[model samples]
Target: MQENFEDQESVEIQVGSEENLKIFIVNKTLLREASNYCRRRFALELKYEEEPIILNGFEPLIFEIFLQWISNPAPRITYDPDRLPQEPWLSNAATAWLLGKKLQCSDEFDKYALSQFVQNCAFMTFGPWELIEKEATTGSLSRFSDHWVAWNYRLAGPGRNEYSGLRAARATLTAPVRDPRTFDIEHWYSDCGKYMRPRCLHDPITRLEKLEEAKRPKPIPPAEWGRSTELRRERPQ
Candidate 1:
């Protein structure tokens, strides 16, 4: 019997510059499904028999995260205290989001990265608005930045209009607010009145619960007698 393409680890991805180049081995089927960029590249080739693909100007760490996203069953963007400090995590998340766009990664992967970035910003006293503005120069990212600024202004409310950037017009807007020196997740969580947790934080728990509910067979409706009877008749013993 012939081996399945999905099971073959035939793709080698080389990320980053010559000085700090790193190679990643990935399954061709999974890589093709996860990234449109890779799919197109593979299609163009007459015969791609384990040819190593080179990706220039990419952070090796970010690229690794992309690989993990495709390989794992349930991939998540999490902050690791040991590998990275809290402040840099936000920046990394932004980088990951940009990387996803560049690679034309699946919607799920891009959404997760963006959600992490937004949630990370919400937890902090202030965000790396300058960096976000700098990075989001065009396309969907630019629109996202604009929406983020508007959203923050609404959350800040009338009395808490201390942020100068928020007062500016959309076109003139630079950074949403000034950057903070430090961010304490515990402190942010504790102050419920001042800082409400973003929906993204609770999403994982709620999403799983919803998925479990969806998986289980729903009970026949008691209110609709005819429909219930029909359903019961249709069901196999």
Candidate 2:
């Protein structure tokens, strides 16, 4: 018979290493619903209640944030550097994003974490660039390379330049054709707009060319000019 996870009120989950282990008692139904990793683990285990579910290789704080998100209907997980000792807000947010990726959390969770990461990158001067580079190179955060490149363009810090090759590849793959006539002003300010700009990860000469092209005005069509001239001639003083 298939077990009904809803009947269980809560389950104990142990995280972190033995030296600094932390236990979390969370609603089993919510946990199962929120995390595919937890859901699969619970489904496969016949006697989950006999012992605390061991979740290794995760920090206590990261798991706490994950639990808080799963438990509350409206989670308020903000980026505050003081929230965690010795860890910067950017690192904390990045760790949460990685945790969400590992757990295969809900789409809401993914978006929330990703947004936090992006916002932190934009506001802060420095971030966990080494972690980001490692993850992107290993394909862990490969899908978010566009975002990384976009923000890097805006910041242009020294640390980020170390991994220019990786970002250059992303920039090249996502670079759009330069057409001044069809240029979008609002889009030029958007996140993807960074990739579309001449100042992106490419040759300086090429970037200058693209900037000049964007500055050039579109020519008026001959038919439109003829109509305007005819209208002016027919108009009474």
Candidate 3:
């Protein structure tokens, strides 16, 4: 199957930038069923354009994974922490989910990808809470942070700003959402519960719990130690 896509090379996709241009030779048939974006892109007559399909707003690796998954549904991720890289699996899964949203993939495919992403997070939490929280708080991966918190709500439970991203994502299919970081899952539950009843929020623990308060990073204080000593010595010491 891999060989067929590579050897046949019916479609030519030019990705990356001028300095590091990559030309991926692929089969159109594999991509035909996956996404509307790819379908439309594949349908375009590439003969007229000087460059290959210049897909902006996506990293090349993330885009490649999107292609690989379309070629073979349900990515076969190795859950072995020692073998696998720490960040790629979760970050890539999040990227793919966002890509699916951006492309407006079919409901079935979208749900399937979402399930895979959630499963990845579940597996990740078992390895190291520190890594999971670190990635979650990075805030670089769109729509992923709250879901991580939601998983925490299901697995253990964190109180502050847990469901906000999920709420904002559900609030609109359009752009310009107010503070994507602060929108909570309860708002999403209220608005979108009827259509998509996510179990994490559905059977959520209702206590104001700080699941990892002790593990949370402490902020360093400003320069006060030297000044305090100087004042004490001048006054009485």
lDDT of 1: 0.57
- The candidate with the higher TM-score, 1 or 3, is 1
TM-scores of the candidates are 0.52, 0.54, 0.45
Write candidate 2's Cα lDDT for 134-213 as tens digits. 66343223334444554454455454463466554355444444332122222323454444444442334566788899
Better of 2 and 3 by TM-score: 2
Work out candidate 2's RMSD over C-alphas: 10.1
Clashing pairs in 1: none
lDDT of 2 at 138: 35
lDDT per model vs. reference: 0.57, 0.57, 0.48
Which lDDT tens digits does candidate 3 get at residues 1-237?
Answer: 012245564666655566555667667666567767767766575645534555555566766776766776763332232443344555566656566656646554555444445445544444333333444333223233443444444433344433334443332333222222222323322433333223333222312234355567899888657877788878953
Badly placed stretches (over 4 Å) of model 2 are 1-8, 47-51, 75-89, 123-126, 136-141, 145-147, 150-237
Backbone clash total for model 2 is: 0
